[model samples]
Target chain A: MSDSETPQDLKTTPLTSEHEALGARMVPFAGYLMPVQYPSGILTEHTHTRDKAGLFDVSHMGQAWLKGPDHETTCRALEALVPADLISLEPGQQRYTQLLNDEGGIIDDLMVSRSAYPDTEGRLYLVVNASRKAIDFAHLNARLPDSVVVEELPQWALLALQGPRAESALQTIVPGVAELQFMQGAPFEFGGDQIYVTRSGYTGEDGYEIAVRNEMVQDLWRALLAHPDVLPIGLGARDSLRMEAGLSLYGHELDETVSPVEAGLLWSIQKHRRTEGGFPGAERIQREIAEGASRRIAGIKPEGRAPARDGTVIMAGGKEVGVITSGGFGPSAGGPVALGFVPPELAKPGQALELMVRGKPQPAQVIKLPFVAKSFKR
Target chain B: MSDVKYSKEHEWISVDGDIATIGITKHAAEQLGDLVFVELPAIGKTVAPGDETAVVESVKAASEVYAPLSGEVVEVNSVLEGEPGKVNEAPEGDGWFLKLKLSELSELDGLMDAAAYKAFVDEEG
Candidate 1:
């Protein structure tokens, strides 16, 4: 499809009717028809997952493969655009990294896994955010060496089983999956189809991401929900989950204007690449690492229940310091939390701050990233 | 049930003498997704027809709940302060948002009946 014609403008997921029947408030998200919330509010869904398990249909995300002669060549080709050192990733290991623009700003965050299974032909597997998939694909195509080939795995549908009980409940369908450690990907047969199962998820919990073929997605979704502990969650809960976990959303925490260093994502950049300085915008990135950027990303905890939505101004000492990137009522915390860029001096863990919501200034406190403690199996 | 009328905004009012018990229709609450908080008008406040009176915030968006008819606010649902999702749980029953003393009963004539309201919802579907 052309870049101008969004898939959301033409496509609906197989679970569209299922969401509608459950009284989900449908919204257009990343070029797909998605449920932002269901009959149970976001707070309820978020809290439920923290205590139980919530199923999310994230099939809109792009799944693709890079198959070629050697792993070194493929990893080197990818490193040209991203700041991560893909060559050091061990077999079955996955790394979370961002694609960068010429200016060293982030294009999108993606998960890249090195396949160890002898049966698999592909050397590297990639999954990127749905909203940035088109541009990312184009960027990869333009930069990859001729020796490497890129193929879009459109046959797959991705589902996330998240929360504390996710592993225990999912084990009912895919036995022996609970043993898979975090940030590891493996192939498993379920519901009569071979699906890619990853021990990682967006929520701050121990969960799995299952990638099933498009034709069998609905069947697999039904099979997982039949476990009695799973509930079909919507985008609303997904947002709150990631926020509490302190994970960055593409448009909110990352954009073409901000580099990875300023966004506090230095861990994703490989140490070798940091010194080698070959990736796009590496020079600027290295400079920012040595001399701190003017603005740095930080978390905000509002005193009241009222949500300080995006674009809310962050103030310190009666002066405008920054703008809120993502803000909402965190169900788990039972109060509003926000992520925004502020001056480096005030970005500490417990600095006092204020947010202007609806012309009223509400007191807040600056905290470190990940407002909600992540329970991911490291 | 003294001739309760509904509006496209999902509000319903049943006249009892000169007073009207106002609440949202079940369909409106369902369409609004999950109700997280409700900002209601103070009792004894007078409001004109079509004036914005209350704010209903779902997890996804915050929407204003306009007054369906001109009236003097007599009572607000204090229970909502503790549990706002009551609007989603029982939109027309215990979830009633407010009660008003009507300034003009004739205003009820301008609204739709239950049958028309159902048809409106069906069309939206």
Candidate 2:
């Protein structure tokens, strides 16, 4: 929802009191009173994350588990909804996938990790966008067989520690976290509490996303901040980070109207799934895969200081060709960067286009994705 | 400094003779947080009191700065184009957004002084 909306009845995360204590500028985001930035401001917070480590209280994201008698059954049930090859996902490994509608449109994009914990065998841990959590849960429950149950784990809070030094900062308190490679997760003990730690993040940096019980998250947050390199970042910097990393935000880059292929997420779909054509909208998606989609998401670099924000029209030869999905000033990139959907022919890196920003036709050019190179430790 | 007045919208105007210097209040800058860009009114443009004469944008959002009184814009700050953070650094002094030649001195009577503006902000809060 809009940030300007009244937050009278907005939900607060477990760290809400802590955020207020830290003098965070609280705003209405996805029905939650979330921090947009702290007193240090967005610029410093953003640069610090790129240089050091920034801790993000992402408790607003939806965490859950899907349970069945065995991994095979659970995976098959999930494969029916998504085009990812969940059956082959090795234990402790995570795969990024999307919940697809019948029309091949995206319901929501999510991270699915096969639980490596012995006690949680035959289960899949999922993290979905907060705004679409309810819709995603209902969609999963309605589609999965009676043998599979969807469990919404509302008792957990997700925290992300991101940057080049995130591992070192976290390894100080939670030893052996460095052993976990990118996209790998495992159970860990912190302060006598069992927490799920995943070596993954959206910032395109070497980081970890820790999921802890709500009761113990505050302690974990405090312990992480105790490190000199760790700073508490808000949603403002988080948006810029992900945007620079070329990650797709739910409503901005993806929606019910956009397909995964058009969003440039074809790599997420498995070749076997693509060939089998069993998932929803497989016919259309396969067709689009074989024949390129009309419009594809591409990176845009505006020529001037002003940003070409969301919904700004893209023009080629004075004719409207596309619209910007996500656009802003990237702190690390030190300029205005944007992501938008344009005709496949015009998606080339060197192709020139004009952005109609504030009624002015500003010169822009298509650029390679991930304006900043990814630094994820493989 | 005693000649400065504030608008309910959080704009500040300082009058010396017929020229008025205008900028946003510190409270406004703090609320906006981290100015990334500032679009100043064009020099030589005429503006009436309450007209949107400038725009201040932060990473989060953009807010319009309304004119405090009827005036003809005399000078616009171009330094903000290279470093908008000046608005957040020294909004009252070096961050002054524009200078205007007052067309109607009576418009100042409708504005609030520093004390009245502080009270107004507290009441709104």
Candidate 3:
């Protein structure tokens, strides 16, 4: 399709012009003008970030605040949808959770932060995926109590600085960033604009996600890129990185069709939330957690170098057990890796399996998730 | 150097002394987006034109490499096992897939020249 199409009409991030100047292969992602690859390509970008640092423009993701009179009401209203323990979230702490439909299927996986700012009414800041922003917002709005208000912060831009040297790189800009533990959020100022820095990211690295005003995002990008250890990363690298890290991409691993339990994200469900069973689909999720799901997410490593892709059939004992949800060459693992669902009995690590690729059954092994060990700085 | 023939699949082969050195062209690498892993053909495996000989996988997609000529793989680039991005970095140079002992040199006559391959790519685009 031509670039003139609505999705490809390509909403520019503040760094769009900068990306073009750097000769990035621009593509449409989540309604934004995003770099799918740079001159070095996804493989180089993927390996570089795993070994060093990669800067990403994630402005397409939605960031917003929930304003309410008290934390209890706010958390209760939020718990009506997500499985996270929003009520117990401490100041600066972040929780990774999903908004579930009534049927227990995932709508979106997001991060909810308990803001330290006492004056912020909702006391919570949220970051949701770009593709599901509208749906997530609408879902939140309709279910929220009158006392709690969800405000969409569309004027902000999100940037992810990820890799081994991410903390040191950010420490150069915000000196105390290293003190913030993983999944914690703090406010930092850059170029006289309010920037919210969070010590969490998708690349399974020690990094920070900086949220800034849309107008100042370009400057923030330039400032971060000025660091010698950082390189501009694209969605291509981002996908491999997340896949290698075994983090779930919203659409690929968690979606309206899959529940958190089946996606192997049961850890996101709080114990109290489980007992309370107030959130959408809590009944199904809790029962699955207790009784075990019929099928569970797994990591599949194909024997040959040929990578199995999404929709590839997973076979075991001569039967179609499940299907590959996401698969590709993992730059970090140094081979082809995949995420798929299989019968619980076959979900063990290193179980022999086969994937149907190109109509041929390729030998594979059912391995544990995060085919590569995660190196997140907790 | 310019005497080599190209295929619509973006493979190029140069013949010398009944042997052919084959590799993907730069355009193919660019089109593939990224080179993450390459499944090379086994040495001494016989392949006919259009037969699947190798597999090149990017982060987003996987593509099969077809044999451009009937031959047996004499030498596969073992170095690419660890550095597949070399294909994208230099598709026609250090990224050469393999050398084949040609079974029939006449197979080269059906492939396009560089100019023709470029035109074909343009038309496909």
Tens digits of per-residue lDDT for model 2 on A259-307?
A: 8999999999988888897888899899999999999999999988777
Model number with the top DockQ: 2
Best candidate, TM-score-wise?
Answer: 2
Question: In candidate 2, which residue pairs clash?
Answer: none
- Evaluate chain B of model 1: give its TM-score: 0.95
Complex DockQ, candidate 3: 0.65
Model-by-model DockQ, in order: 0.43, 0.69, 0.65
TM-scores for all predictions:
0.91, 0.98, 0.90
Model 1, residue A192: displacement in angstroms?
A: 5.0
- Order of models, best TM-score first: 2, 1, 3
Sort the candidates on lDDT, descending order.
2, 3, 1
For all candidates in order, the CA lDDT equals: 0.85, 0.92, 0.87
Ranking by DockQ: 2, 3, 1
Tell me the lDDT of model 2 at A112: 97
* lDDT winner, 1 or 2: 2
Superposed model 1: Cα runs more than 4 Å off: A1-8, A14-25, A38-41, A119-122, B1-3, B16-21, B42-46, B71-74, B100-106
Candidate 3 reference-contact recovery: 0.91
Model 2 CAPRI quality: medium
